[model samples]
Target: MQGLDEQPVQAHNIDGFVFLYSEAQQKRYLSSRKNLLGHERVLEQAMESGYRTLLPLQFGLVIHDWESVREQLTVPKENDLKQLFAKLEGYREVSVKVLWDQSSELEQLMQENAALQAERDRLEGKNLSMDQIVKIGQAIERAIAARKQAIIGAIQETLNPLAIEVIENDPLGEDMIYNTAYLIPWDTEPHFSEQVEALDRQFDSRLRIRYNHLTAPFNFAQLS
Candidate 1:
């Protein structure tokens, strides 16, 4: 029979071999001084109980014939396995610790979200108030009316003839008018300008004439 430390023996070619623990046999060879002769005796007894040699590699001891090994090897009962229970307890403790940390973080986020929602609700409430909304709408209407009046006055003042036909007026403002246009005779423009200048002096602040180029009513020849 070849021993385990006898130069890495192949199990299929060997008639029989004794498996030894590398822990017990510190040496790599069967003939070395560190070879455990006492453990070899124990392994021989185990092999007689129907245990068969299996291939050995890098990992820990692997022997076939489990039933024979079970009968020969002494192991603790399930109730007396303290090390297994301790490992499971440690895993449970770590899992609980992780879950607790996650729960605290979730709660803090929920609280912050709730505060932001409350602030949003307050702003929405202010925006939806009937009085506030009505006031804003009224202000906008007034501004639009003022702008329209200004545009009409500008158009009326810029056109020649000083006779602006008023189409619309603002009910709220006295001088504000809308859609006014001017009409002037094409030949009388120079004379009309002298009269307009005199009128402008008379009512400089009250009435202002603005002139714009209009298409001549009819083209007139120069009277030389």
Candidate 2:
């Protein structure tokens, strides 16, 4: 709880976990909080309080009045909310974003893919037909897809032992392949994060791995 107040975090104890909100003086502070930093701190506080499960709210969740809070926490949604809390009791969300280093990946592909090399050689000759060019382009694309798939598969395999569920997010860019999240137990987080470090090394400077353990379980807890 050290420095808990120093940061722009002001919260309230709700039904199952602490809920963070912006106070009158904290309005500007909350507005400026970017990248969900304060929101993440709320999740950390929940975890510290022995509430392994959490119903993570987005940042900038401001409670305008106490009545709304009471109504939301009471009878109507109470039972269902408790069920969610129960389900998430032992789980914590962890995120992993695997970014492809295009230059490095392309270099590796060009070096190891004999077919692409052959295609390059064929394309080097003068008077190549349009169909030949298309075929060579298709071959290069397929080779890149195959290699990317293998990398993702290896990452999933590395994380399978530690995660309860895997959730894939939309890729960030042409060079970025996977933006995934996992629902792992509170106890296994250390091991899972360590595995990510191993993956970063195994990719050998070709893939950049970023992980956020304090992320909300939104990826896993999305409602139907």
Candidate 3:
């Protein structure tokens, strides 16, 4: 064994003897470490030059022409190489497993989004049906007709003073009419119920008398 300080400067076989360098030399090598492209260039150049470089251990100096110097550079048996290849395959499997898990999570999220979109579309369709403008128009027409008939019947029976002209019989429907205002006096309002009751007894089956007294422009007898 040679002392650390007195070790031979030059190595006999680059592969057989491990190169030992000072701390300063190690730092210099670290600083000179090549990038990916530089390393690829170095490998290509070395292959063309018929030289192989190898680092024995982490702290060992780089050895050029390792095959010429070291017997260990001799190719191993097929089975030995296969076992090393299997270890690398195991590392690849672990990486694939991690990626597959992430892919599964993404697939689940995509399915959930699709379901939400479908539900939203269904709700939108239902809302459109409920708020349909044609349906609203039909309902308004029916309500107005029913209210108009009620007003007409109430006027005929409750204030039977004179000619109740149907001057503007603009019926929105069979039951509803527009511009069917009455002509009745303010004083006859006290006897309004007696007149309405008399009409009710006579035409109760034929007409409906839903009366709400309203202010009129003229007397009941004058309009008649």
In candidate 1, what are the lDDT values of residues 1-224, reduced to their tens digit? Answer: 33444432222311122334333233233443344443343344433443422222222244554454434431322233233333222111000000012233333434655754354445564546777567555654554456444544443454333432212222223332332223333344455456545645653454434432322111111111
Q: RMSD, each candidate, Å? A: 45.6, 3.3, 45.5
Q: On residues 85-180, what C-alpha lDDT tens digit does candidate 3 reach at each position?
A: 333221110000000122333334346557543544455536456455465445444544454455455554444343233233354444332233
User: What would the per-residue lDDT of candidate 2 be over residues 109-199, giving only the tens digit for each residue?
Assistant: 8889877786697669678889987887887888888999999999988897787778788998887899988888888888887889999
Total backbone collisions for each predicted model: 4, 0, 4
Query: What is the alpha-carbon lDDT for the whole of candidate 2?
Result: 0.74
What's model 2's TM-score? 0.81
* lDDT (0 to 1) per candidate: 0.35, 0.74, 0.36
How far off is residue 221 in model 2, in Å? 2.9
Task: Write down the TM-score of every candidate.
Answer: 0.23, 0.81, 0.21
Compute the lDDT for candidate 3. Answer: 0.36
Instruction: Show pairs that collide, candidate 2.
Output: none
Candidate 1 accuracy as TM-score:
0.23
Residue-level lDDT for 101 in candidate 1:
28
